[model samples]
Target: MWRTQKTLLAALMAASFTILTALDFCQSTECQSYDNVPLNAEMSTQTVTSRWKNVSVSNTVQDMDYFRVSCKKLLEVFPVDVVDGNFVRTVKNCIFSKSIPTPLKAPLRLVAVSKDVIEGVLDLDLSVTQSDHFLHFASGGKLPPGSVPLAHRYGGHQFGYWAGQLGDGRAHLLGQYTNRKGETWELQLKGSGKTPYSRSGDGRAVLRSSVREFLCSEAMHFLGIPTSRAASLIISEEQVWRDQFYNGSVKKERGAVVLRLAKSWFRIGSLEILTQSEEINLLRKLLNFIIKEHFSFISSDDPDRYLVFFSTVVNKTAELIALWMSVGFAHGVCNTDNFSLLSITIDYGPFGFMESYNPKFIPNTSDDEGRYSIGAQASVGLFNLEKLLQALGPVLTKKQQHQAKMELEAYNIIYQMRVHQLFRAKLGLLGEEDDDAYCIAFLLKMMEETQSDFTMTFRQLSEVSPKQLHNRDFSQMWALADVSSHDLFPKWIHVYQHRLRRQMNDSDLERQQRMKNVNPRYVLRNWMAESAIRKAENNDFSEVELLHRILSFPFVTQETAEEAGYAARPPQWAQELKVSCSS
Candidate 1:
């Protein structure tokens, strides 16, 4: 009996040592696959279900379709260029160049469609989207009945210098459709083909970049950021070549197109080009038209309508950038042309959502100087606003121009206020306190030092109660565990708890609910998009469809998302990923 007891003790000791070794291995790089242990794995489905609001991915499609079958409405309203057909030349005195989309000659395949966007926004039946007519129309293979395609003509300040005649080189505006719901949507085909502005380049978008644009556009929208919508992504056998990294190594890639939707695509460059070309009369005409159509609140009779329009844009732009920061999104290209006058997320290229909290994170490989990093987006926004003010200089009175500059100056203040509100909500801090800002700053500093996952850090905080946080019990909460590794983490936690207690009658449950709403559990991380794109390039769009469905409700915890390892630590290969302005 004595020998058996000694043997049992020895076996127990050996078991303990093996478990510890395994845990240590998981903490190291060799166990990257299990980076996040999903501590709440035991939580009941009911508990998880209660956290998310029921979001319908698609509305019930009606038997009848109300899609406008042509571009006649837009053509009738806007001024046409003097030149009639597609040719590379300097365009003058026109809002748009009358051009036709050169259809893809190869066979087209409808890769994916946003049923919600079709039924909700366009008021079209879901059945209509599956038809050959829809496929051809979306891919630029066939024009809609009575369609008259037009390419917008605008110049821009590309990378802080005047880039003349940088208009819609590869996009054709297919026309405007006013849905039954009384909303107007402009349908445009990106990668449809060349226009007069397609200088020295083939008017095409490759599959890899097109996939990113399509996914990111829809993802941003569902993330509650204002953005242009993507109705469908179509792929074709048509071959296109691109030096993806701008290196000498060019590769063959399949051509693709996205049928994108927007209320209006008139950007700051719209006015800049007219002002640059000394088309003051046309500039004023365009401004008046925009004001009348989009800014109904600004009276057409008001002499200072342009000033009011400028002020509204400045305010909206500030709010937009603040929201982008809250979600850790970097647009990658914040050029004057890309910054929409409507203050929506447009021209999605080389964009990325922040994974690790690095201020100097540049998503676009072409952006060597880090001009459009996530941290610098707000400042870049100000620069773009300055260019916008300059664009409006020709139309504004001297006093109004002064007022516009003043509005531009107020941008930083407005942006800071919005950021403060958003970050406070992320921390689940109720009401204001003197130390709230400092506490928030301290937490962010610790997160940066530890290289914490930006999205999951806040999300994990939302998941854990104040008791767990106080006890430093971050087992299986991977992002929080990373952040807690900081030497000063305890000190920051004390400040945060003190600030949280200062709020009157804010229960832990209430705080959790508030934080969960603002802090999304998922974001379209670059690695996830890269995975989807790889399968898409192989003519397998299952992941694309899955990502679309998952991203449509990013706040929810779906079983499929968990099984797919989306919220898990990005795979090792993700670090080698690179995005450029090639597409």
Candidate 2:
């Protein structure tokens, strides 16, 4: 009986030891929360100190820990003090929480990291492994000290109707960080987890959509378009059920997250939210913060500061739409909320570059009305700007409002001028002429009628010469196009030749080279993106890496034979690929 009692005591002792060890591990590694953690708590000194000591260090032996600790302490104590004084003093109504809800599952693998963005923007020597860890912590919903995330509230016009309180449903904005150049950038995690605004969403981003965003963001940046930059991509083993088509057919998919870096995430909808809620004081304060943070060059002391701000926004919007038109890019959802206040492309859902030169192409399957079609983007941009102007009603005087309207009226003229300039560059026309617009119109009309490949057509034009018009190569190229038998085709070419002749300083070769530089040989074609997605889903990441390399230098011809397939016309099956806002 004594021996039996001793064995029970021994078993009890072992169980107590295991429980103690687990409790210690939980304290040291993961800080699981039962409720929403306060943002202030997340930015506390002790919390940041613990994270600095626990997180993995990089290979660079330059005392990065000290740098990180110093930066974190500075941000924790004086989050806005480092920013321009105007912003720190004026901004209000921002939601702050100590700790955001963590993802359902931790990141299992590091998919990709945009090294160019990290080296160029962040000025950090973070290796892929380090980046992976950082992304997992920041985007996987792991809240460490100095990593407090903010979710901004906003309203928007969706499909020409008001969408109230549509804020960052699954996005969390981590505090801003200063780069080596002293430029401050806001880092945001999309598909991190649920927020107050996630009405019915699971708040998880699937791998398919995550991959699309990761590649497209980099592709647009390299294409010389202003867009939010992607830093890293992380995938989780957790499964997320999604009705990809919103048709009630739900399926489980792999979850993922993307870390997006930008100058600011403020949008027109942010202001609209304040105005619509009758928060006049908050609206004015937020406007001041925006100007102070992003447009510091425009002095707040000036009497016409608001008017000047409106005009600058108008100009930027016009230029952005013109750029989109030049590249045949259709942003499937041009909702006011998706329209960045700084005029950079933000969300990447359902976006498409025209495979054919059809101006009426609509990429989003949900956009049945074709309101945001390629042909309608410019008009929609102006429409959204008008909504922004309305949101500023509380701040502007009647006279100033009239002035804002006048500035808004200049959008069409500005858009036309920018479009002409872009097309001129594409055609290698050194001098602007009265007939240039007509020539461009004719070329576009011909392309639309023939259903010719938009990118390839311009690229091929660079190789054609006046002397080769009657040759077999030119005949073959012309045959490939849906050319009309009418004499208008030859007439347009005659006009084009006359324009080329005036550029005596540039030889044929120089002109071709110039055109090639402006016209990209590669775009993130639907087929290519689909192939990358499929391969990634199957655990083959080689295609994603290869596509990244090719897209990095889009304007130059890739020397490898493998790239030949990417440059060719997409397979017929590519036509059935549908992308929607859910993407």
List the global CA lDDT of all models: 0.79, 0.70
TM-score of 2: 0.84
**Cα lDDT for residue 97, model 2?**
27
- List the pairs of residues colliding in candidate 2: 37-99, 38-97, 38-98, 39-97, 39-98
Candidate achieving the largest TM-score: 1
Name the lDDT value of residue 27 in candidate 1.
Answer: 31
Candidate 1 has what TM-score? 0.88
Estimated TM-score per prediction?
A: 0.88, 0.84
* lDDT by residue (tens digit), candidate 1, 1-583: 2233223222211111110000111133312322222212222455333322232224433422223334544455667898887778889888899777777655777888888788788766778877866776787766554446789999998777889998999999876765445567788999988899999778899898888888889988988899999999888888899999988999999999999999899999999999999999889888988888788999999999999999999999989988998888999988999998899999999999989887778899999877777777877788888888888898888999988888887886677667777887999987765555566667777777888989999999998988899999988798999999999999988888887788889888999888888888878899999999999888889999999999898888889998999878778898899999998
Look at candidate 2 and tell me the lDDT of residue 513: 91
User: What lDDT, from 0 to 1, does candidate 2 have?
Assistant: 0.70
